[model samples]
Target chain A: MQNKITIKNLNAWFGAKQVLHDIDIGIEKNGITAIIGPSGCGKSTFIRCLNRMHEVVPYAKASGKVLVDDRDIYDSDIDPVEIRRRIGMVFQKPNPFPTMSIRDNVVAGLKLGGLKDKKILDTMTEESLKKAALWDEVKNDLNKSGVSLSGGQQQRLCIARALAVEPEVILFDEPCSALDPISTSKIEDLMLELKEKYTIVIVTHNMQQAARVSDHTAFFLYGKLIEFGETDQIFKKPKEKSTEDYIIGRFG
Target chain B: MDRLKLSFFRSSRSKLSGDFIFEAVVGLFALGILILAFLLFRELFIESGLSRKTFGLSFLFTSTWDPVNEIFGALPFIFGTLVSSFLALLIAVPFSLGIAIYLSELAPEKLRTPLSFIIELLAAIPSVIIGLWGIFILAPFIRDYLAPPLSTYLGFLPLFQGPMYGLSMLTGGVILAIMVIPITSSVSREVIMTVPTHQREAALALGATGWETTRIAVLPYSRSGIFGAVILGFGRAIGETMAVTMVIGNSPRISESLFSPSYTMASVIANEFVEATSKLYVSSLIEIGFLLLVISVIINVAARILVWKLLKVEGGKVA
Candidate 1:
């Protein structure tokens, strides 16, 4: 499989405390890669580094090579804004822009980038919302505030917002953690559909979710990657003792 | 066992009585404020009864201020108060928002605390000292450097048409602006800071630049709050007496020129109340005081509503 993103010896720190140890992983193009780990295992930080978002926190720093499409994203000349545009992220909690209407929230990424053509914005909004499985539900209430929706709908709205920019890769930082089981299942199905076009990376604590939807799985523990392999192999015939123990609900 | 149960019941009853006393005491204090407000209004109303009866509604429309003849009108003072306060708002709003945005969004982490402290210090300075500064420094500066260029370039407008006297409406407006900036900016900074991190991150993830994120996410989210701050500033400006009185030239004449001398209601009352020997003269000044009080109450109520709306929206408890 062709790798869309390559990380080599990535290290991250928040103030004096280092969180992500030396790590190496590759995300495959047009595939969903699930990173499963216990709380505070640095799974979220790893993906944040891929899009140069780790440096946004005050006193937080990272040292690594994150190569996207064979170019180092952390190169001094590269713009983090542009890097972020190409790599979208949906947070654990659904955070649709509260001030914006449903339609405006979807087109916010494009509109804020100075896209003035209303026809294009309208088309893109419809297309992106349709892709996120939210168009039919929100089409009539395009003028309603984004936060007026249910938690699950709001997450889908955020996904639609991310897709509005037409990013090449999408990152999910526990996107379904705050959602109900039905919403979780819906998101998982949507991810399966989305992987056909965009590279997908998910950080999830739900092992069953990782086993159910991911083609490839990476198990992380104590700021280190313990195993990376096909989901079937990792679940059925695990090579690492720690991975097996974690998969079978042993000590996290 | 019976004794232990009786002791427990006695303690619980005492606690309930303590709670009732606490509620009644606090409730009385809250009602005390309302009663005090009512008493103040009644006093002003009774004290100004002579002027209310003599001038009736025409007092609002007429511009005459003949203390020698004891014939007073509120128009000039009303105009001065509104124009100067609005001018102060026009000057302060931009600076306040800029300061707030810079402090909350753009300033370095190390600078935030010191800058905030300095702004609060500005607020803490007494209005009389600011009035003194207006007399010594601000008025002369406006007369020499600021007024000449403004009149020469924008003189075609009526507001900039007159001679540049140092102590004039423009100076009063500038003084009020200086006095109001600290409160407006600090409140705005607080409102902007309340914008959640997730909102900013959401904008950043959408490829928004720093300014774009602030414009799209921060400003809109805090719109009502910033407006409430501005209104609060306006309330302060309209009621400002010392600094404005020192620089406003205290003339009871209306003019189209901002450079012309003016008198605000609060300033006029402060200047003339103690000196007035006649009952009617004192009553007229008290009438102006009553007007000022009414205007301030209206503005404060509006500000409270806007701020309350902001809280409701943020709390997500009301539609």
Candidate 2:
């Protein structure tokens, strides 16, 4: 598989304590890759590192190369905003812009990107909602507040919002963790559909979810990438004893 | 028999419920305060009714305030109140917003707490002290230099005309502006600080610079709260008595120029309350107090409505 993102010897620190230690991983292009680990194992931190969102916390710092499509994303010359535009992220909680309407939420990144044309905004909003499989539910009430939507619909709306920016890659930080079983199934199906057009990376605690949706799975333990391979191999026959132990629920 | 005795003892171990009584007491305290406010309003309205025959709403429109003829109109006071407060707001908003933005978004971790305390301390200074400072130092500098040049160029406008007097509406407004700045800035800083981290991350991740993120995401998200802060400042300006009474010159007559002596509803009441001997005169003064109260309530209500509408539109989340 072609590499869409490459992280080489990446280390992250919060204040004096380092969290991610000498991590190196490559994300596949236009494929759904899953990151699975026990709680507090740095799965979320790894994804945030991709979009440079981890830097928001005071005293949080990262070192080493995080290259997106061969360009160093962490370079001083590169703007984080532009990087984020190309690589969109959906958080664990359904965070659609509260004050904006459903229609407005979808096109938020574009609006922030300075796309003011009404026609273009409308077209992008429709296309993004369609891509996220949420167009039908929200089309009638485009003017309704984004928060007024159900939890599942709001999550999909957030996905649509990320998609609206036409990002090359999409990151989901345990997107289904807060959702119901039905919503989880729907999002899983949507992820499969999205794999054809965009690079998708997801962090999940559900072993069954990783088996269901991911082309490749990266198993992490204690801020280290322990094993990474085809999902079936990782689940059925893992190389490391730790990876096997984790998948079988023997010990995390 | 022993088991039965132990069970009874366990069942009776629950604590007494005094929480309900405590809650009732607090509720009664709140009710008492509300009742006091209502009674004050009612009394002011009743006394102010004495002047209604001579001064209708026309009192609000007419500038002539003649004490000898017992003919009192509020136009001049209204104009002075509105114009000076408006001027103060114009100066205060940008300055306060800047201060708030700096404190909330820009200040380093170590500096943030101290700087915030300093700004809040400004709010603690008594209005009389501020008035004294405006009179002794700021007024002379403004009259001799700032007002003369500004009046020369902008005097064509009614609000900035006439001779540059040391004691005028301009002086009062400038002093009021300083007094009000802390209220606006501190509240706005708090509002801005309350903006969710995800919103800031969302904007920054989009590649927006610090300034752009603050401008587009943080500011718009907190617009309603900032507006509430401004209304609060307005309330302070309208009801401010000692500082305004000292510097506004307390001329009851209407004047177009900022340099001219003027009076506000609050200042008028404060200046004349001691000397007002007649029952009708006292009632009229009380009426001015009534007007000020009504104006403040209207402003506060309007601000609440706007803020409610603003909050409902967006889930208080910035995209």
Candidate 3:
């Protein structure tokens, strides 16, 4: 299988405080890989580095190589804008552009890309909403403000916006952490379905969720990856004692 | 319960406690302002009684201002104020928006804060200094060079067809435009910054350029607040007295040309306030003041209503 991304010897920091320490991992194309860790274990930091989103925060720096399809993303000549174009991100909260209509929100990414054709935009809008499983609910009120939707619907709308750009990889930074159980399950199912067409990486605190959706699991602790393997192997028979302790809830 | 009762007894309650005294003082302060407003209205009514008796409501419509026989009308002043203020907004809004966008989005992190502070400081400079600078420097330059050329091409416009006087409504309006820019730009910058980070990020992630992201996301998100800021700046332009009075030539006759000297309600009041010898003259000026106060209040109320309506459109979550 072709590897979608390769992160090698990755070390990251926020000012003087180091976060990720020598992390090396390869994620396969069209696969769902879950990064499971306690809060502040640098899982979110690691994902943000993939698309250079972490650089938005002040005093943040990262070293080592992150490769997407053999291109070194951190190379001096490589543009962060291009990396983000290839790898889209969804945040923990549903942040739809409140000023835009539901239909406009779906086509926002395309419009931002400078695609102005009305017919093309219409097709993309419908297709993106369908892929996000929000077309049925929002189709009637397409002209209403995106903020008028329920929280769960708004999150799905954001997902549709990301999809509209036709990115190869989608990174979820604890996307459903702010949703109820039903919304969470729906998003989980959407992720599984999404992986058939696009590579998906998810950061989650719930081990059961990691086992349920991800084909592979990488467990991080104290800013270090303790174990990485098949989901069943990582959960049931983790070779590292720390990984086992974490998976069994003995300690975080 | 016994301990609480003992503590309560130990802390003696006076007739006028700190909270009551503080409330009383603030209450009296608020009442003082209300009383001042009432007195101002009463005085204006008394002073305007002559104009009401002589010119009647035509005082507002008549353009001829003859102070020789004490025949005073405010049509020209009102017209000048509205035209100049509107022209100032037309020039200042786009310029201020560009400054705000540059300060908020394009400027480097090292420069953003300092540049923003500088723009805000321009707003604090006394209007007299700006007026003086306009009178000596800007007015002469416009009259000698720019106005003559503009008139050569666009003189067909009634506003541009006139003698190139250094001090006229156009010169005053341009000066007022500079004055209003800092207020409009700073308020707009604050509003634009409040547009959620995610909106910009979302646009950027889709391969949008920085300019593209701002155009699609930042501008739309802050549209209502920006409108409100423009109205507030318009209010400042309308009420600005010292600088406008100096540059506007204090002409009270109505003219079709912006290059002609004209006077605004504010400039008229300020120019005549110290020189009024007659009770009726003072009262007319006071009535002008009353009109200005009412106009400012109306602008503020309209701005608030627009903000409320915009919020309602945005899911009714008031800022």
**Could you say which candidate leads in DockQ?**
1
Q: What 10-residue stretch in candidate 2 chain B is worst by lDDT?
A: B6-15
Across residues B1-319, which tens digit of lDDT does each residue of candidate 1 receive?
5323523224344555655566557878988999999999999999999999999998899899998998989999999999999999999999999999999999999999899989979988999999999999999999999999999999999989878779999999999999899999998998888888888899999999999999988898989889999999999999999989999999999999999999999999999988998999999999999999999999989987887777666532124
Summarize candidate 2's per-residue lDDT along B1-319 as a digit string, tens digits.
5323422123333334354445457878988999999999999888888876657787677667666667777777777788778878988999999999999898887899999999999999988898888889888988998897787788789877777778988888888899889999998898888777767765665556789779757897888888988988887888788888888887876676778888888888878889887776777678778888999899878766665554454434443
DockQ of each: 0.63, 0.41, 0.51
Model 1 chain A is weakest, by summed lDDT over 10 consecutive residues, at A47-56
TM-score of candidate 1 against the unseen true structure: 0.94
Residue A211 of model 3 has an lDDT of 93
Better of 1 and 3 by lDDT: 1
Count of residue pairs whose backbone atoms collide, per candidate: 0, 9, 1
RMSD after CA superposition, every candidate: 3.6, 5.2, 3.8
Under CAPRI classification, how is model 1 graded? medium
lDDT (10s digit) by residue, model 3, range A181-206: 89888889999999999999999988
Stretches of model 1 off by over 4 angstroms after superposition: B1-32, B315-319
Looking at candidate 3, what is the lDDT of residue B68?
A: 57
Q: Which candidate leads the pack in TM-score? A: 1
> Of the candidates shown, which would achieve the greatest lDDT relative to the real structure?
1
CAPRI-wise, candidate 2 is acceptable
Q: What share of the true interface contacts does candidate 3 keep?
A: 0.52
